[model samples]
Target chain A: MAETYPKETSNTVNRYKHQDPSIPVPVVLPMIGQIGHYPSDQQPHCYLHGYVSSRLMNLAASPPGIPLCVAATKLDGFVLTLTPNTHNYNYRSAILHGHGTVVDDESEKLWAMQLVTNSVVPARYEHTRVPPDNAEMASTRILKFRIESASGKVREGGPEDERKDRRREDVLAEVWTGVIPMYERLEEPVGGPYNRVGEVPGHVRRFVDGENARRWTYAVEAARKAAPIKRVKREDEG
Target chain B: MAETYPKETSNTVNRYKHQDPSIPVPVVLPMIGQIGHYPSDQQPHCYLHGYVSSRLMNLAASPPGIPLCVAATKLDGFVLTLTPNTHNYNYRSAILHGHGTVVDDESEKLWAMQLVTNSVVPARYEHTRVPPDNAEMASTRILKFRIESASGKVREGGPEDERKDRRREDVLAEVWTGVIPMYERLEEPVGGPYNRVGEVPGHVRRFVDGENARRWTYAVEAARKAAPIKRVKREDEG
Candidate 1:
């Protein structure tokens, strides 16, 4: 889970606000996050950057912090089966159960900021204006999440049909069962209004080309693989 | 909110258990969901299909259902700025607060089933084997979400830098700030081992080509647009 989004830093974080003891509900926030092990830390944890609601900000300021579930899901392909009920997705999902606290240490905060910035585009922090001013540092708030437990699941390969459906020649003849490869693709860079640089930087170009190629290969390869014999029991299964 | 994800159906749902009043944390599950209004109903609601943990299933079975939050996020592009703190992503996120109950009404359940199947690939339910048998229907479970409220946010356009950074000639010249367009791309479909059909059907081909074009256009257009004058106040703002 710690290395799930080393490059792609988008994930949804779930925070529960227990306002009433009798009833509890979760608040979901789409956020940018990166997992890294600080030089001085014993293990890796997650650093989350987002403007949480004021209520959640207060929750993070308290002792022991707020309990959170950080999740990242990547869709590889859509598996088309003989029946709609059996259709599934080839995907990878990672979830971490943790407690989040607001990072106050200047050094750790700055390092985490660099880690997150680079996570977006490799070495992007150094490419931009260096060492944020006091005002910038003061304004930024990062949540340091200490993960207690984590789990990940990966499902890949072609579509799977039930034995009964496989035996029916009529259904097989009519229905088109297969996998549609899908992935996040980075298009050519579009320079900003203030950009004075003659050409897209080397770092930016590399990231765009490299990610597109890697993602395409992964999705197509997954589509070509054999389906798992014992598929995870979905809600549609009796 | 009801019209959100009318075509692409992927959302993460957060469910919390109040087993212990002293401690509460959210459980996040990546699931397939779609929003639709049945002809018999006055308003639209979300229908979710997934194999939830047994505990969550039990919770949903109880009266009033289980309180939940369903969220969908789409990243349009990466916005690069002169400073690391100002860097952001052009994206859209939607969240719905609701209670999820298992759909028991047979007719409604069947309708919701078709709704969710087509959400994956347009008109997919009818293309495959028709009318699930009693066993298939008995095994499948669809969660009907009664929407209490919902909200959404969209961010777009080029990089935004602070006044000081914009004034710095050296910083402006050095940093190649811009928007790198990003979007999910669907590649050519690959048939499964047991697929008897020779060519990718019209429905599957249309979905792949149509979606790729639509997503690509949206991302590039978003990158060329003007940034919001007063961006959402992020944690990095003092």
Candidate 2:
């Protein structure tokens, strides 16, 4: 399937952080992000939620939202090879480029709140205290970024080594080439200080169990898949 | 202990992407990265590896190099609360602002290659084919980013709810407040197509077992800790 979004297990977003408008200072904020389409929109826009600094809020509140880019990534496995230069990772990454604006419509904001809450755990919105009071609603801030352009890439399968390394019997015998599967594993729920509920609810339990199984399977499967066409190795710096 | 760098398990880097020189297009590339201090440097800088587009390489090749931001984050858990607004995540995030340049010194490049290789799995470089041949070395590219300014944040502990929701007996009684501990889990290694080694090497096995244990412990511990001071809920939208 051509997946346009990261798996359900991923709900995090990273946006470029600019310290000052005059100086192009590159920084990124790791925040909660969900993709949703409001009633009035034809296409889905990204909704960002988290501790947004006041400067970013001000930038977004102006005419057009701050120029924003959203990136999400999930590491599947470590692809080990006969040589250090050939080592790679099985991963999925997506980036969205757009201008972000603060959402002012109350109903649209309310809808986004519900959409994001349930995105983590199904039916979580209805299960929680309904209709946030005026003060609660007033304090919340969500940035809506209508994606202008987007792209993604997925890297998978076992290691592919150079002809020199592959031909060397000594190297092949000494080096253990393979993939170390990696995934996000969710463990048992630990109740908080004031939790009164007797047992974990059905929604939470189901989310935990379902996600664990899916993430594990994906990582292992990616590790065993066929290798992609070889290209020049790109080192962070050489 | 205060960690200036991300844990050993994390070797990935995310840099802001700009498509056009004139138009600021926000983009991010997920690539392999490591931190190392060359013998000549006063302090450590970030060493980046992996497939870097020609445009980015050209930008970095310039006199000052490209303005770069590197971000790293690890999700510890999902903090569930009595109300949707109070939901949170236990995470560790770091951002570094710097200028990236192409490494011209072959000796420094070779040292970095070893520094990054061993970072993922201790002593992995020695285990692999020694001294990448001239062809192999020539094809590889790594980016050296001198650190200018950096910052990081860590959020742990279980959820904290509002007084209004905490006071409502019905809400407290129904809601299951807790944290679903999450971590990057490394599974059994699967040997590749051309592997001749009979057993998984000592280094790979130790890495998988050691990381799985450390990551799981950290996540569960974070989930049970005390929550931070109450703050206004930052919604994706209000």
Candidate 3:
């Protein structure tokens, strides 16, 4: 895990070392990432996956950052309505601003890209094709925004809910209110037909291994909760 | 739908009219999203997420006279390696650049946030509850990035394939190569558990009704193929 930018020079090695190494840094970091939504218009505001992880060049490559420090979510939902202005989507997002940096060089590039990949399947880099060449290596531009500060916001229910909200009468409205969750799951891997291999790698196994296997060490527990619920209760016939 | 920013005024309309409408606007955008890495670590890189988006925006999102654009992604994993550096993960992303506008008003704010939301979930905005109180709308920051150039990049397959790759290269390293394809699917809505009355709202239903059920949407299709095949009958089966 080599540090990419801002290398330590002979002159600056102990420039700040002698001083308080823990002086607060500025909120100079920039925000990046995507805002995802549900495929269905009805359940628009589903889940937003964004985060700001800790970035102290001194703490990278070894383990990288764990359990992302700051995260944000923007949920959205459509309001099929009688008017265009009335036609809207509900949403909420939590933006956690902080610090993080990009993996530097070819090796770290490979490591980080693989990290993102294995987030879906463990040991995935070990189970897949090696990056073709320097060109392949150069193709990916990974960046990290070290943590600084953060936040979260959301919207739920439906247009009727808001309209009833608008009325705000003593009577309770019949409009339904609830939240629809969105999830990203692993699909069964499709091994190439020509590849003459049967044994799945431990890394691949981490993602696709059959049930009753090792649990995902990373990823949010929401996914674990999303796993299949076998209702096959072995109940007493009595 | 309001079309007018809450602060829209006649003077502002005349000012905007002086500017060329098609000449492009300023917004966040990106060009080449290079994920740099360092293999053999002396020091480690942070894997910049925030500033990368910022820098990408630096390239895409405008500053003064430039147009708007964007290059956004969802960080899906952290590829773990056999040795520590070899780790990698599967991911999906889109890179775009062009005219953009930093959304700064109620109307654009409303739509921009919606656009970002629906970026992940199609038609979601129309299906959920939206805030009617103008006050809540006062603080939303939405940016409009009109894309001029764009492309897509994705990584799939497991480390097993790479292992086989290593064998062909006379590389004794039994590196695993396979996919841990990123997965995101809709979860059932936990409605009013009490179920006092009423059915699902029309807006939410649009989303749950399967905006992505067609199996041909960009978001879902990108993921579906990443899994291992179960059975191979005949190609003509389709």
Candidate 4:
């Protein structure tokens, strides 16, 4: 889901570009039944979802399914202002509202499992063992979520201090204020004990390098107030 | 809050240790009024909070106050299994239930602002401009949340596949299964345009290097099933 905020608003303020999804965002899966009861006057139902094994799924499965929510966030930069009052962060976050249910269909469960595996490292499913055996399939449980609503929020750009602070010559002269760009960097992969492979596989290496560069470039450019360069020309473009 | 999951249950499983708060988790402040209304049948009082300007706070202030929730999560590693069916992730997450209100007291607001700034990078508050001026204070809005409830959930360690898969000699021989350690690395800090400082400050430099080393060591040791080396002996030790 994409959201737009007024230019003046503190949240949903995009700097480099509006509603860019290529930037990797952190994902969150809220826990179900973890938070105790909210007052009756407050919102009653909160949802959370996570993967489960068949053993655990059978134990928790009841008439009505479990509640679940999935969320992800991408931190852009740390906005450092001259004063603490104006400090802020640029970020993009999304939340998915859903309820968790067991994936009963064998093929669908396998597909979901593969999807999740590949999500950690692109195309990793093809590199590993193929279809799981019957016992493995029977023991594994996939929590298929039926999503109800989803929302995305974003905040970007340099610090937004008050006009008076910005005008203060003395403070501005002494105190340096700007964003310290921050992004996750994937380091050189360490091989496992039984990793028979001579070197890190091409796919794994490429994914690590590619993702690190993409995020680093985006954050540095955003801090410098540079817009992302479009690779393809659109028909509507003048 | 700490949750104990039944050995047979799945969602709240804690693998390595229980409720270790030193790990840096991603902090999230839910935005108010951004998420559309939840159906009363679901959860009635769903509260969220986001940072706002002092100007907006005055306009939005009302009795009974706004509800809010703060969340943080730390991703430990990606659990890679021989088969796709058993893939999982190691993580730690915390949530705080609270009500948001404006911090009207000047000193308290400054203190809270400093606390938050330093939280991003330890000792960072002292490095920047000191107490905010009146106009900066007037414009900045510190959301003093009255926390009512809090809870933490965690998952860690290697993949836990079906017993049959673990026992299968042929599967074990051919298929490699282990965790791909993952942790957030702070990249080289970028200086601001007007940053007159000759180099990255010692404290900031040390923090970046220290955090990277700490996380890297933890992930590597966990991947190898090695216990962390204790820097100091506990009081209980002879």
Candidate 5:
């Protein structure tokens, strides 16, 4: 079943909507690349996976009305050089900003807490006991910060900085420079219902195949490079 | 022969000097920690290691400098829950403000690039070939930004959101809530000066040992835990 809400436009980020009841504005779709997913309805509560450290929350809240916003930036690459000053890096990130509030209402609180868990790992809520009734859960202060706005920035490239060191090209230091691309995979659901049956679903099949395909392609490429006669090796190996 | 400068007490970070220009900045005694060294040598310079992106340099430059600066933050840990939104993460980063400059002086430019390299991998400068040339290095719009003011922030902790959470402690989904610490090592120095005959230097040895020790200690503990049972099994087999 699906319930449709108005798609987030530019306006939502500019203005605060659910301030009083303090409902945590859901996380905007994550910055997932080609195969990554903003998986739908993974848990009973339709919530996205995210959490802010209590300390950061408190620090970000120091400005009174202005909430602490977090922006996660990842350095994907480095542009190196002959001169010391020229080196730089390329990166990606998630920016989360808003005045978060503590989950208080029993029902909404239950959902928020459960959603935090399930959003991170689908169905984790089911594996454990319900949260609110427990004393440990009752004691910790989890505030629901109303997300105000956020944006993403990414960059990838080679030693574009070497232009100034024109003469240094032929002398290109032997420092290794290239992408050893990182792959992200959420392994087959372990210890959950799938583990008991010892069967993974078709949906999970893609995640597995994608990983293997990536590995196999790399392996084949390595073999081809190693072969004495490249084309001859290809035929012999095939 | 050795040249010694009078030790300045007031500004510890700025006073420390690199005794050897050949060693990577990180390996040079004074450059070890977060503190820096940029004393007034015959030619004055600054100890610049980590900071913001190149845009920072432009922010502080030329005609009517821009009042605003950009920031880059990173969230490293991914807290995957049953839900999608809570798949959070932990991380480390630097957000800086101010204008950076392009070093024009040949000597200054050379050392600046060296500092950046050492910042990335300690002792990387000596192991790696010397900086290329102006053209190759020029591609990196290396702007030297004088950090008039800046700060670094770090966060660490388990999912405390569970405090306000409703779930009980023991059964609290039994979700993994701890750090997956990040460790990195420089590949055993390959093609270096004395690459064939030399054993790793004491400094490099100390560096690897410090981090690798942490990693292997856990393995040793794990092996110990299973040793008795393994011994008994071997005897039975015999």
Candidate 6:
């Protein structure tokens, strides 16, 4: 039989539409089995994961779950305006609300560990050793959060100066107003002291270079208010 | 007459001694006046500032003030172990607990704005227009938080695998274990469409390059267990 999962509510979709889908956004859901039925009579809860040492886990374990908020921001550019007050930044940021709790299931822990590891560098799981040893597994901990709500906010394009500033001849002539694109870049990998491999592994190199290029292009295009070009057009085509 | 401020306890100093001083770590302190003396009737609080529209501020302003935890992580390296379970990351992460509120004072708001701007890029405040106009000032908002507690955690150097894995003769010969240093790099600045300037200003250029270099050096040195060289040593003296 095919497996089934809960569908996303329109509320959730509208809320996170502005967020970069590549980044993981925690959500709350009911636990269900492969047969598409609820695993038990228990109510739905938030399932989130983080490192064993995460402070979020510690806070959650204490008495009632800790009311927590997580915010991540990606700076696209520095927006310069003719007037200092009108200066702004082109950015994309998300806020998540949740209550943290530790996960004790071994299998669930392993799965979450793999999920997070691969999230940092895709395909990283297959390249390394399989299932962790008893001690290794014991050392790792998982945090399950109860997510309540989340939202994403974004500001893009050039500066938005006041009408007076834009219309003033002196201000318009003397000041340059626009955006200076900014994005994170990953440098070429440097081999470790004990690395016997002569070349940086293909996966590592690809992740570093690919992520940098993707982010750079996104920031520049967003600042310019240009839609991302997915394919190169042929010169002969209209 | 001399003014005095509350001093950091020895316990706090010992706890944060290992943290990199360059990064801002949030702290909870009593509300104080221009002389740095705690106001007689006011209680202790968390003081933080971000761009006017920061979600952090909005969340903090709601009702009883959200029980907020702020976390920041600086990835030093990716630790590759012989086994997947043993693989880890060398990093420094800090968590702060606080309750947020808005600061309505115009002078205080401007000061915080300048402080945050300079923190992003040194000397940036002086390079930009001096005091903000009335409309500009009115648009900006500052958040003051009531901080409860904070702590930082750091992991550095190479990977640590299980004893059995390390002792296995075959595994020792076939597997590589070490740290691949990672850091955030700032790329060359892209000028705005309306920028008439022929070249990027010296301060902006210096900030992008200098910050990148500093972070790169710090991550690599931490992974290698080497003390950072503060300045170039004379060849003759060495």
Best by DockQ: 1
- Local distance difference test, candidate 6: 0.52
> For model 1, how does the per-residue alpha-carbon lDDT over B1-238 read when each residue is reduced to its tens digit?
1111001111222122212334546667788999999888887889999875555667779877877778888898999899999999989877776678888899999999999999989989999997999999999989888876566678888888888999999998899989999999998999999999999999999999999999999999989876543233211100
Residues B29-109, candidate 4: write the lDDT tens digits. Answer: 344221122232232222222456343355327643443345566666666665665555556665444345565677756
Kindly report which residue stretches of model 6 are placed more than 4 angstroms away from their true locations once superposed. Answer: A1-70, A98-101, A146-148, A172-176, A226-238, B1-47, B50-70, B97-101, B145-149, B173-176, B226-238
Models, CA RMSD each: 7.6, 8.5, 18.0, 15.1, 17.9, 15.2
When summed lDDT is taken over every stretch of 10 residues in candidate 6 chain A, the lowest stretch is A29-38
TM-score of each: 0.88, 0.86, 0.43, 0.63, 0.42, 0.65
Docking class of 2: acceptable
List the DockQ of the predictions in order: 0.43, 0.41, 0.11, 0.17, 0.06, 0.14
Model 1, TM vs. native: 0.88
**lDDT, model 1, position A207:** 92
Query: What C-alpha root-mean-square deviation, in Å, does candidate 6 show against the real structure?
Result: 15.2
CAPRI accuracy category, model 6: incorrect
Output per-candidate TM-scores for chain A, rounded to 2 decimals: 0.86, 0.85, 0.36, 0.69, 0.46, 0.70
**TM-score, candidate 2, first chain:** 0.85
Worst 10 residues of 4 chain B by lDDT: B1-10
**How many residue pairs clash in model 2?**
17
> Over the stretch B1-238, how does candidate 2's per-residue lDDT look in tens digits?
0111111111222222323333354446776789898989888889988766666777778877777777788889988888778888888877665678888899998999998899888889999987988887888888998766566678888888888788999888998999999999998999999999999988888999899999999999999886653232211110
**For residues A48-138, could you state the per-residue lDDT of candidate 1 as single tens digits?**
9877555566777887787777888899899999998999998987777667888889999999999999998998999999899999899
- Model 3, range A176-196, lDDT digits (tens) per residue? 443454444445543433334
Give me the TM-scores of chain B across the candidates.
0.86, 0.86, 0.42, 0.68, 0.46, 0.69
Candidate 4 segments whose C-alpha is farther than 4 A from its true place: A1-69, A97-104, A133-150, A155-160, A190-200, A226-238, B1-49, B52-69, B97-104, B143-163, B193-199, B226-238
lDDT of 5 by residue, B1-238 (tens): 0001111112222212322322111100011112233333332223343332343344335532322212333343333232222333433334223323444456655566566567654665664445555554554433344333233444433333433332444433444332222222212322222112235445445554664565434323322221111110000000
Fnat per predicted structure, each in turn: 0.72, 0.71, 0.22, 0.26, 0.04, 0.24
**Predicted candidate 5 versus true structure: per-residue lDDT over A148-238, tens digit per residue:** 3333444443333333334344434433322222222222332221112234433334544564465434323322221112110000000
CA error at residue B134 for candidate 6, angstroms = 2.1
